[model samples]
Target: MSEEYYAARIPADIDRPDAVVARLTFRQVAIIAGTGAACWLIFTAVHRAAPHLPLAILLAPLVLALTVAAGIALGSRDGISADRFLLAAARHARRPRLMVHAPEGIPPMPSILPKAWRRAAGPRPAPLVLPAAGVDGAGVLDVREHGYAQIAACSTVNFALRTSGEQNALVTGFGRFLNSLSGPTQILVRTRRMDLTGLVADLEEAAGALPHPRLEDACRDHAAFLAHLSAHQQLLGRQVLLVAREPQAAAATDAGLRLSRRHAESGAVLAGAEVSVVPFTPAGAYGLLADAIANENPGGFQ
Candidate 1:
């Protein structure tokens, strides 16, 4: 494969600090220019009509401020200017080029705004599907609305600590495992900040339970040392996941049979690679999803 083919492709609309200046579209520029011209015309007409009036003099600064505000409002749509609001309004209009009406017979969606504002607001896009629902007995995950069932949770080997010969063997084994794969799979490696709350609590408990003063002092010192290390170090833990996906309707088949086959195949491949692997149980998979939703890291072996 070509290097360019494998290269990461960032979207054109991806936000960056310099994008505000660099990514000005034609619509954004038009909105800003139009607002400025309208404001200028209105200000000039008022000034010309009542040049000697005291009120006109006071209104000059106010008119200038209003012009600036209007320009800002019109230009600030979707990072560029207020053209986004105009586009949304245009799209939501009855005779829009493309109109997507709400489904019939269902209650209108709730909005945070008051009723009048809600009515004035443009139509919004439908909500996206949740990333995951829960896992099944076959260690497969029910990815709700995504039309896929997945099984995940795999372990890794410590490659850096291994000798040259061991590393070569590991590389060969991994290559073989990859070559043996017939279907699609996703391999994920995630690194998360380690939480030491439980360890600190355990250490405190152990320290309190010690009978001898010297031992208790020693335990306290050890706990304090651990606490210090936790505070100072950016301790990170890494998890490996191997996800096998099938159709959501595959649930109709025997779950045990499916899980056993997947487990046996993966186990044999990983065993040859000299890597420790464990499959998450249904409850474990659910817990993993829940933890991910809550943004909690619940593991060790850092």
Candidate 2:
């Protein structure tokens, strides 16, 4: 490649990738961990009488190897990329683009750099690809997207009602919708445990104002309610699933609310592309979010 081409690419890490240098497979990691543990026990038990060898030398590699193995095993397979964030910054120029903070920060790009690459390097190098921008390891997806698609998280409806027919009808409608899709479609589901720290604080504050005897009763009731809620929540943490058709195959419709002509000046959906994330809930709520995405990005509706 020409020097100009090389200048455009992000510099590879000076250190070798853990996978390449350590020969540290997941199995090796497990072995290293176990070996270190065993070595520790052996050295501590025998080192007093057998002080001929420096035990640290034998164990140092084990510790170092174990740390690398742990990091490799835990790190995302795909590192952060810098395409979509750049595009959004160029296209709309008005929205808050989700981005992973670059290690060295976005740097300057040479004159030969592509517009996309230049955007990723605001002042330094932040690797971001548009397609992967909202992916798990890429930039966090902004809550909104322009032409690509639209999504909203709806609260889940509790299904513990006594009315069987109502539940059956709802499920039947959902099943029919799933069966109706033609071409490329995708569904995403998300769920999360609800946080009630503020609620807990409020309850504590209320209890503090009560008389001593009544406060005990309040505490007991609060504890019981909390336990009950926790048990129920543990069984039913939030989850959301996405169902979508490919942008090109989606039916025609108006786009979601773009931030603003002025605000959107900094961010734009280059194509019918978008990603939104919300805490997961039950299937019905997830289905509603799918509908919302389709509604917001009409052209992509299928």
Candidate 3:
């Protein structure tokens, strides 16, 4: 990546700062600007028409001030500049979850205008644009769940190369596994990217500290191998596959939670944790897969 692109990414050392943009909504800016313009125009006209009238001149400042104040007060719901930003805080907050690492000392985020909102009815919380809450681990909410299930995945296999006996065993085992399920299930896939800088970094030590010349070549190869892997990975997106079924549909039917089709034909609920069904990755689906390798001899390790 170019230096500019790297610089664009969030830096590792600095915590994301709170927003500083005090963007007045279109309505607020219009109201204030319009009122200020009108008041100033009127003040100018009055001064021109009544140049001898000291009293009218004396009231010009008050008129301009009142117009500006009214615009600010009415447009902003009475809060000063600070409260306007505070009202936007929720948008930056993420959804609440169970597994997120709640920092030990949840220091309140600082604000420049702590008391600004006392002046008006700032923007409603729902209207702000907010970043997503970035927590994904089993949230505190999930850990507290009354019941949950974990599943494993099965590896992809070249079944066509297997003997008839092996194929039959595999087919039979899969059929039996499918029959074992009962519950509501939802399949979820999580994907992410990783920085491979650490892997590439070991090259320096390999080059500098290794005593054996051959080992240095090996280290160079390792670094090149890692570089190739990183290049491929950069082009390849992460994929996590899950196959889930919800027995919860049946439970919901019996337990009487509102149900929707999991699919048009398959009978799944739109939601409700009770929607329980067994789920597994491809790797999770097949048992004895590792043991069933073609070359496994008596007492030989896989």
Full-model lDDT for every candidate: 0.64, 0.44, 0.43
* lDDT tens per residue, model 2, 33-104: 676676677667666667786867656765776665455454443352223334455787654455443535
TM-score ranking from best to worst? 1, 2, 3
Two-way TM-score contest, 2 vs 3, winner:
2
Local accuracy of candidate 1 as per-residue lDDT tens digits, 9-55: 78785662332433644554555566667767877787788787686
Candidate 1 clash figure, as a count: 7
Is candidate 1 or 2 superior in lDDT?
1
User: Tens-digit lDDT track for model 3 on 48-67?
Assistant: 88788796656767676866
Runs of candidate 1 exceeding 4 Å displacement: 1-128, 144-147, 229-233, 252-256, 295-302
Q: What lDDT would candidate 2 get against the real structure?
A: 0.44
Q: What does the lDDT come to for candidate 1? A: 0.64
Per model, state how many residue pairs clash.
7, 53, 45
Q: Estimate each model's TM-score.
A: 0.54, 0.31, 0.30
Evaluated at residue 177, the lDDT of candidate 1 is 77
